[model samples]
Target: MNLTLKIWRQENARAKGRFETYKVENISPDCSFLEMLDILNEQLVDKLSHPVCFDNDCREGICGMCGLYINGRPHGPDDGVTTCQLHMRRFKDGDTIVIEPWRARPFPIIRDLVVDRTAFDKIIQEGGYVSVTTGGVPDGNAIPIPKKNADEAMDAAACIGCGACVAACKNASAMLFVSAKVSQLALLPQGKPEAARRVQAMVAKMDELGFGNCTNTYACEAECPKQIKRSNIARMNREFMCAKVCSEE
Candidate 1:
């Protein structure tokens, strides 16, 4: 198929950026969005021009590195899928596809379609882990967990930190992302010991990093590639309140 692409182009973090148009032809419908971009880059290289810079790894969608705003939607117009998983078939021939990076203050632009998502790494570093030692793998039945809690924990654990939640919010809130991380640990017995401290530290770090507050718009939930529920935000709020109350005593 033939398509027109209006992609953001920036030399570096401090450089001014703009949309540069290009045309791609004869692209396979099965070609992934990143693959289409690769084709465009190759065409530019043959002309001795610089290629667009976009982050991508494990194009299989496990890694959230390929964050892009396509036609005003994070990861394009798809539901529960990342950019790398998006296909050229989603667009029609002669369609004009607008591609940009995640637009959020916390995620500073590094170059064309590339943003510094190290803010997420910093938030994770604040306390998104379980420090307790299990002392080798325990038998499945050893630490019996309620199936409900286990399922919910696994659901929350599906978050890939793609920054789509932040980009989807008018306020650029990271609540959905932060809440998923908090709930993933808070729901599990293995994470119980550090639950309070983990929630407190992570929330504090989120605020420190300039992420906005959640106002229940649910845009994050709708745009999340993993469909990470806004319920995780509710769970996080409960954890935060409880942690604060206990700490006050």
Candidate 2:
């Protein structure tokens, strides 16, 4: 299959950026999206020109390192599929694909199709984990959590923190990401110890990073590659409100 690519090109984070068009010939329908980019990069190298810069660590889609805005959607047309998992078969021949990076205030573009996602790490650092004592391996059933809650927690835990939610939200809200992180722990018995600090800290850091607030648009849920529900946002709000009110009381 042939494709016309309109990829964003920039020298660096501060350099002026623009879209540069190139034609990709003889692309296999089985090629992963990144593989198609690799072909483009190979052509650029042969011509001694700079190649497009995009993020991709584990091409298998487990790491969520590959975050992209394809055409217009967060991860292309496929439902609940990460950028690395997107295959070229989904697109037709002679398609003009528009590729861009995550457009959010916090995730400033570092170059063409590559944005700094350090803000996510900062939020996690504030409080997105549990503090367990270092020792030998603990038994699996030590916590004794209910099956239903455990399953729900795992569902929320599936979030890869790809930032698609924020990129898709008009307000650039990080609520969906933050909520998934919060709910994954808040539903578990082991996470109860640090639940209060986790919720308040994550949200506070999210605001500090200049990410906007959720306005019930549900766009985040719609764009999330993990299909993490907006209900997690509701759970986070209730948790934050209760934590704040109880602290005040």
Candidate 3:
């Protein structure tokens, strides 16, 4: 199939960016979205032109590094899949695809389709871990955690930090992402000790990094590749309130 791509091009964080169009032909329907871009880059290189720059580490979708706003949706039209998992077959022949990087102040473009997502790393650094000494891995039955809490914790832990949640939010909020991180730990016994501190620190860092507040638009939950729930946000708000109350007391 032949396709037209209108992709954003930026030289650096401070450089002005714009959409540049290119055409690719005879792409396989089975080709992954990133593979299609690879074909386009190879063609440009043969002509002595610069290739499009995009971030991709694990093409298997586990890494969440390959993020692109395709046709105004994060990770294309697919549900519960990352850009690396998106396929060319999802588009029709001769279709024009618009691709851009995550558009948020916290995720400034480094070039073309790559943005500096270290803001996420910074938020994680703020407290997103079970720093307590839980000793070595215990026997599965030793913990005896309620199955419901364990299930919810595992679900919250599915967040891959792709910034899609931030990109999909009308306010560019990181609430969904932040909440998932908070809930994953707060529900687990290993993480319970620091739940209050972890929630406060991460939320404070999220605000300091210029991420917007959640307005309940639910776009983040809808676009999240892992289907991370907005219920995580509700849990996080409760955690935050409890922390505030405990601190005051």
Question: Which structure is stronger by lDDT: 2 or 3?
Answer: 3
Candidate 3 backbone clash number:
0
Candidate 1 yields a Cα-based lDDT of 0.92
Q: List ranges where model 1 is wrong by over 4 Å.
A: none
User: What's each prediction's TM-score?
Assistant: 0.97, 0.96, 0.97
Residue-level lDDT of model 2, residues 144-221, one tens digit each, is 889999988999999998899998899999999999989999998778888888899999999999999899999888
Clashes of 2: 0
lDDT-sorted candidate list, best first: 3, 1, 2
lDDT of each: 0.92, 0.91, 0.94
Residue 115 of model 1, lDDT score: 97
Ranking by TM-score: 3, 1, 2
Which digits, one per residue and each the tens of the lDDT, describe model 1 over residues 1-249?
999999999998899998899999999999999999999999999999999999999998888888999998999999999999999888898899999899988999988889999999999998899886668888877888999999999999999999999999988999999999999999988888888888989889999899888889998999999999999999999999999888552
The sequence of per-residue lDDT tens digits that candidate 3 reaches over residues 96-189 is: 9999999999999999999999999999999999775767788878877899999999999989999999999999999999999999999988
Considering summed lDDT, which 10 consecutive residues are worst modelled in model 3?
A: 131-140
Question: Which numbered prediction scores highest in lDDT against the true structure?
Answer: 3
